[model samples]
Target: MVGRGELTDAAWERIGPLLPGVDGRGRSWRDRRKAINGVSWGSRTGAPWRDLSERYGPWQTLCERFARREADRTWARLLEHVQVRDDFVGAGEWRVSVDSTINRAH
Candidate 1:
């Protein structure tokens, strides 16, 4: 039962191998797929981290992993891979929107 923004089995098969596992103490991270799904949920919804659903596991874990991966360029690498693959499979669509609704004229 994959949600609207979740990674499907085939998508996971492509992405799971590329995620980092070793934590600061070398403890292999658990439930990474679950955490990633939560991350996806956050991105899709633009919701506060504290408001994340429990089924995604702790919000702290998802936030920390997202920050760490972002700092380490893992996200960039993964995006490049996904973009290339999607282009190859003809699923690629590029669009841009500039939203000013959140801007405040102070």
Candidate 2:
């Protein structure tokens, strides 16, 4: 497997299927994926949106999509659904750890 900073085509393939579908405007799923990925990539790389590559999507569009999703609770619902499915499917075991101690200062 390649290290970070490298774009694996599989990553794109995995995310491609999960993006929202286009409507009568005729936008492609690829475009939506690129926009979403672009914002994540920029944030991961610590780069300005203007520096984002076209292969992703327009920086403005990416930022806007992310913002809209955040405001609309789409991401929240997605996370909840993923957690529920993971629990049911046993994809990964969930472990909870709690620490109980009294601080000396208290």
Candidate 3:
């Protein structure tokens, strides 16, 4: 069962292939999707990594996987792919919001 903020099977299908595959010489990593779900959950809930649910595997593992993906620009590529596909399917709506107010430190 998909939990709140976790990627659905369809959503995972769209981005799963974009993640980096494990090298045979290195130690095998945990499931990419589950780790990613942990990331999503943590970000959405604004929770600490150490508080991650065991259902998503160890928080440290998820953090490492996320860092590796970010370092490799896999996340950027996945964003581009998803944006392009969503635009093609007429499902994308781009928007930007700016808060122009500046606060001075007292």
Candidate 4:
């Protein structure tokens, strides 16, 4: 059961292969979908990683996976892929709003 703000089946199908361990080289110790959902939940709700719901598995693992992806530029690649796909499919406006006031470097 995919929740609101979580990736849909179609979306996952497109994005899953972009992630590590989908190539059958090695087993992934964690469930990728759940980890991704946890990341999404934290980012969308602006919740601390430690506060992620258990259904997404260990918060630390999810946070680490998110950070690893970020460091490796996976997130940026995913975004670019999605944008291209959406453009080809004629998907409507993909707008993003950022509140810089909440983004102070500390």
Candidate 5:
């Protein structure tokens, strides 16, 4: 059951492999999807880390996971991947247009 601010299965499939230790040794960490969902919840709601819901497990763990990914530039790569997917689907052109009119100071 995906939570309110969680990625769907398809999305998780794309992102999960990019995270650490999916294929590594030692005891596996908690569910990556749930940890991501907790991070998403915290980001979307601006809630205090300590206030994370128990359903997502320890807040500290989630925060640390998020921090690790951020430090390693994983977040940027994930965004780029999603953007590429969007481009492939013909979602829209990636462009920006700006219009400006300036008046001379009197």
Candidate 6:
């Protein structure tokens, strides 16, 4: 499920130790992870939150959670954590494979 969200195994492994347990509120991290996964899938698929599948719990819940997470910069922290752990790899390895073109009048 995490892979389907475009999370690499190495990145997941690096971030796993830093994640708050979903059970932090007695709901279980597994459940929260699924909820987060729903957000990822929903975003990737451009599906409405109300259309999220039951396997991820209520779509409303995931949507609310995603909003809270965004407000709190949870995703940014996770990326920063991963970046810190991977700092030894250097910037040359962090290349983005993308193509873009711009028109300019000379």
Best by TM-score: 3
**For candidate 2, what is the lDDT?**
0.65
The residue ranges of model 5 lying beyond 4 angstroms of the native Cα positions read 22-27, 92-106
Every model's TM-score = 0.81, 0.56, 0.84, 0.79, 0.75, 0.62
What lDDT would each prediction earn against the true structure?
0.87, 0.65, 0.83, 0.85, 0.82, 0.69
Q: Per-residue CA lDDT of candidate 1, range 23-94, in tens? A: 575456677788889998998899999999999988987898789889999989999999999999999997
lDDT of 6 by residue, 55-95 (tens): 88887778877777788788789878667657756642466
- The window of 10 residues in a row where model 1 has the poorest summed lDDT is 23-32
| Model 6 ranges off by over 4 Å | 1-3, 6-13, 20-30, 90-92, 97-106
* Runs with alpha carbons beyond 4 Å of true place in candidate 3: 102-106
Clashing pairs in 2: none
Model 2 residue runs over 4 Å out of place are 1-30, 43-46, 94-106
**Which is the better candidate, 3 or 6, if ranked by lDDT?**
3
For model 1 the local lDDT of residue 12 reads 93
State the weakest 10-residue window (summed lDDT) of model 4: 21-30
| Per-residue lDDT value at 91 in model 3 | 100
Tens digit of lDDT per residue, candidate 4, span 1-106?
Answer: 8789999999899998988664353447567887887898999999998899999998877887788789989999999999998899999478899999899897
Steric clashes per prediction = 0, 0, 0, 0, 0, 3
Candidate 1 Cα misplacement greater than 4 A, ranges: 97-106
RMSD of each: 3.0, 5.4, 2.6, 4.2, 4.9, 4.4
Against the true structure, candidate 3 has what lDDT? 0.83
Ranking by TM-score: 3, 1, 4, 5, 6, 2
The residue-by-residue lDDT of candidate 3 on 40-67, one tens digit each, is 8887889888998998898887887778
